[model samples]
Target: VLTRDEAQTRAQLLDVRRYTIDLDLTTGDETFDSRTVIRFTVRADQDVTDTFVELKPAELRSVTLDGQPLDPETLDENRLPLKNLTAGDHELRVDAAMRYSHTGEGMHRFTDPTDGETYVYTQLFMDDVQRVFAAFDQPDLKAVFELSVKAPDGWTVLANGITEHTDGVWKAAPTPLISTYLVAVAAGPWHSVRTEHRGLPFGIHCRRSLAPYLDADADEILDVTRACYDRYHEKFEEPYPFDSYDQAFVPEFNAGAMENPGLVTFRDEFVYRSAVTDTERQTRAMVIAHEMAHMWFGDLVTLKWWDDIWLNESFAEYMGYQTLTEATRFTDTWTDFGVVRKGWGYDADQRPSTHPVAPEAVNDTASALLNFDGISYAKGASALRQLVAWLGEKDFLAGINTHFTRHRFGNATLADFIDSLAAATERDVHAWADAWLRTTGVDTLTPRVTGDNGTYTLTVERTGSRPHRIAVGLYDPDLTDEGRLTLRERLDLDIPQTDGRPIGKRPALLLLNDSDLTYAKVRFDPESFRAVRNGLSGLPEPLTRAVVWNALRDAVRDGELPPHTYLDTARAH
Candidate 1:
């Protein structure tokens, strides 16, 4: 594993210029030839003697530093030490035979069971970049990447940039400053759907076996893609950072999707081989919107270290659902996020392995990879949603645009992001970050209501320290039908109340965290609980019902409410 300390040392000493990597995939089935030439400059003021580049190869054929041959015998495990390094510019070339992987780590090769067709794609996330090619494999040491691949006659090559095939060699356009993990390659006899959206080439590819399925949904997929692309362009002042956009549905993908600069890779299952619900299609659209958002949040401006992974995922997650809701037909996207995705975050947060949304420190790469769980994506996005609620969308977007402007094509941290947010608003964003991001577990908000004559005062009792700006919904039983309730009015309230809120003439029920704008376990007041038990299904909006259901689920998990009561409520509703 590449420890954070070692990465920092290498980053301090070397400034990578660019990587020119050549892969010969026609060599064989088990292994392929990989040759990488790295040009970097050592800081003149730093007296660094030696540094190492990482590569996990089947056979280390040769290595040369500054055109001087180095013994291949010196290769150690995943690291090849470049001894006697001097300051100023130097070039390092490595020639090796890299093995293909079946476990979806490095270069994963998958053979279709039905037709004996072959497909391969790189899942070079985290330290897996070494499994394909060699370089300073860290997020902070961003560099330009140029790739040339020699594949079989019928294969198509997809990469981080526009790829052109000429004279049997496919060469990709040089990428902007990006982390090594974002370097992607998927080569196969793909079924491709191509189009032009807003003068940029947009393509989607899948394996031959999934051609018909891919074709069936290609128009819908492209529609969502175009919608998201346009929406992101509007939200982010930074124009599309890359030359084109391509989404490849590759086989045996480990994660749902990877945000490679111009090429985003999704698991081929998204092509849909069977029937799916509208909600499922909406989920797919959300994923499309999510990955497109990464084109700016993750690819354009990356995280400095693994600890700040939330900077990439959380931003994308929030932007994905929000953008999908605003720009596409998937207007009820957050309802799915709240009903389906939010539980993942709450569960992970309560686990023994739970970490803060942004941990103070991730000691090594191994520790960092584990942090990609629900907290990083779901909880972090929820925090951002809450931030937007409190800070207001206009100021929040201003901070985001400022963030992109300040660190375009670079890396940033949580503190840096908070600084960006603080610059755009008068609110104490730093305090919010400390309270929401630096903490673990969920906060409980139990409503306390008291009435005098016809007027009622409401107070929220919080169990945790994080501040939340939430909505309280008031509902009244309909005069025509008691079982059907109508929304009275929604009240916005902030945690740690400064003054008592006297809401004149209380309604039949009081629901906290009404719109699901914040991340907290909300509890209904006694009257509201009774109303929910009788008419929970009367909540007009799916998001409102999701909030109520989630509260009951949390109560059951915490043993505050019996499992049978939850089940009974579900049965009745």
Candidate 2:
């Protein structure tokens, strides 16, 4: 495994200019032929240095630096050393027989059981890029990649840029400056549905066996894609960075989806072989929105290292749900996020393995990979959503646009992001980053209420250091309907109250974090708790209901509310 220090050392020493990779997939089923020519320049001030390229090849065929031959036997583990390199432009060429993956890591090969047709795509996140092509495999050493593939007679190849097939080879358009992990390729006899959206070619692909399924829902899939694209453009000042947009539903994909510039790959289950619910369809749309956001957040402006991966994922996750709500028919995506996704974050945060949303340091790649857990995606996004609630969307978006404009097609860190937000608003964003991003575990907010029938005071007691701007829902039983509840008023409150505020004429239930705009675990006042036990299902919005249920769940987990009580409450509601 490559360490962070090693990646940093290599990144500072060399500026990778471009990579020309040729993949021959016609050779056999077990392995494919990979030839990579890397053109780079060592820093002018640096002395003669020895650096290495990474490739996990089955057989090392040949290696050359400049025009000189190097022993293929010198390959150690995944690294091939380029020894005694001076400070100037150099081209290193590596030819190898790379094994195909069944584990869905690198160059994953799958044969559909339905048709006995084969397909292969790359899932090269982080270190897995070495499994496909040899290069300086770090996020900071951005480079233009030109890929050419020789595949089976009828197979179609997809890549980071537009692909064109002529004669016997498929050549992709050169990509913009991007990390090795972002370079993608999928080749198979695919059933494709193609269209033109805003002068750009948009397409979806799947294996021949799933052609009918792809065709059945092609219109809906495309509709979501186009809606998300338009919505993202409306939010971002920067237009779409890549040339074409292609989403390929490949089989045996390890991740829900990967944001690979122009060609995003999803697990083929999203193609839907069987029946699915409307919520499930909404989830597919959310995933589409998520990956598209990455075209701007992760692909366009990338993180400098793995430690700030939340900059990629958290933004995408938040933007995914938010955009899906705004632009698509799925208007209650955040309700789903609150009910399902937020639980993942809360549970992970409570674990012994929990780490900060953006930890102080990730010493190596192995540790960095571990950070991709719930904290990065769910908790990190919750923090961002909270930031938006506090910072206000106008200023939040301004900061985002400024961040993009400052670091477009380049690398940035957590500090850089905070500085951008600081520029957009006068609020203490750096302090917020310290309290939220640099901290682990969820904060617990328990409400305390006092006073009489028509007059009351509400106090929110926080058990953690993070500041929150949350909504307090005041619900009353409907005058006519016995089981229904009416929204009396929704009060906005900042945590760590100066004093118990006079909340005149408190309703039957007082729910905290009613809008699901924050990350903290909230609790109800005694009256609110009693009301929730009786009328939780009567909450007007799904989001409010989700918040109330989550509070009850936390109460049960903390032993404040008995398991049987929760079950009985669930049954009663």
Candidate 3:
């Protein structure tokens, strides 16, 4: 990624001491200006004759290093050159202005029609961080950020860390070392509910127009936050790394939510201004938990490059559902994952855009942005969940704790995380990582049944190249029921076996990849397929039913089954 390369270069160029960013928020123009002072300790032995700052063309109104004016011609969209610098501590200050981007980049400005309130939010997705400020807009060039914004008198300003209002200007607490893409700010007339939990400030915010809707489900929203926070504390050695946790339901946010440290920005639709299904509410809760996990996994301990972004997102995605299931009232969260999230992974993995969960050699930001798809989030999470199932929860947690402690306030590659896991267990996690994270494409698990005398055998045949840790379920007809199939036993197995497991009694049905914990399409045995078509709802576990539903969903997407057939199957169930 361009951000990764620029970050690596900047890391070599300067030892960034701190960043002091000042913004005039009330600049009513579509464009705003910024002044940044980047102070760095120079190498005493080397004459820093040529130093560079990363900035775009239209952005730099003027440039100077320590008040000496520099030529605009020296500016490259990716870098600004500075000459005649002595080897000592020095300051590189930039005075720049940039227009807001309408296409989900840079500082995005818009006005809310309902309340007539003007709002400004920044969405610097991938490489857009440079559109807002002059810095090394890369993942590894972590910098301590001090932000000050002058906003309209009645509007509030939020950023990556906690902000204190002073003299009509909002000043953010200097952030711990963080990547620029994670730096954020939102300024507008906002409605907010503020509280504290376990000594940490917790708040939910939305535009003034959505205040009524936000108030309706305020309790549930905050309860989800409290539950996930408590759960993460129980799981990790480090507490929440940032100050004050704020979830803002902003308007027309590009993604579900941008995990911007203390200030997370969500699409206002999460406020539920209109009636929505209980399933929708569950989804909102999951998103909250997902973004919260990022506070630790993505924000606290960062990926060394865009290539290792799975270390940030996939881990958060898995922990989100797992924590919600263990700690919150959402006990059947994995069912939703199967029906919705896994479907996303399955669909994307089958598409032309599919990439490995942990992709190797992502050369620039454009390619990296393309990879923020289903495989990275959903399938990657499922793979991790299966890893937890195989390695056991305690060891997985130990490995994760070690990974976070070792990489806190720093950057880590995917290898670093796997090595930590390898330290926690003698298991071949490196091989697991290679098979699951490095390889592209999904595997197909087909259930083959054989019988000998009174015994039945069920064999799992993996059709794809990737290996899988999976669960096979044997179901038998309930003695008192006509159609219901009860789970007889669950067999945990690694896939691609040539032999089969013998059951003393023939099962009414056999299902492959029963839990949907692996990124694979499952082919049910003939009897199981018939059972799924006729009596899927009779399955005891909602998660099992979800898996069956997902298979049908996948069939529809793959054109193997007619869409109407899927609908008929759903209706029959």
Candidate 1: stretches off by over 4 Å: none
The candidate maximizing lDDT is 2
| Pairs with backbone N, CA or C atoms under 3 Å apart (clashes), candidate 3 | 1-363, 1-364, 1-365, 2-364, 2-365
Supply the TM-score for candidate 2.
0.99
Per-residue accuracy of model 3 over 1-573 as CA lDDT, tens digit each? 364555565566666668899888776567787888888755666655566667763557777777788877778656787776777777878888777766667787878888688778888656777778887667777889999998888999988877889788999999999888888999888889999999988989988988988999999999999999998999999989998899988877788988989998898888897889888888889999999999988888888778888767888899888888898778899988887788788778877878888888888778777788888888889889889977888999999999889999998898899999999998999988888888877777788788868787777777778767778778888889877889999988777775787766777777777877677887777777777887788888888887777777766776877888788887877
Comparison by lDDT, 1 against 3, better one? 1
lDDT of each: 0.91, 0.92, 0.82
lDDT of 2 at 288: 97
Lowest summed lDDT window (length 10), candidate 1: 499-508
Find the 10 residues in a row with the least total lDDT in model 3.
1-10
Give the TM-score comparing model 1 with the true structure, all chains together: 0.99
- Using Cα atoms with residue i matched to residue i, what is each candidate's TM-score against the true structure? 0.99, 0.99, 0.94
- The regions of model 2 sitting more than 4 angstroms off are none
- Model 2 superposed RMSD (Cα): 1.0
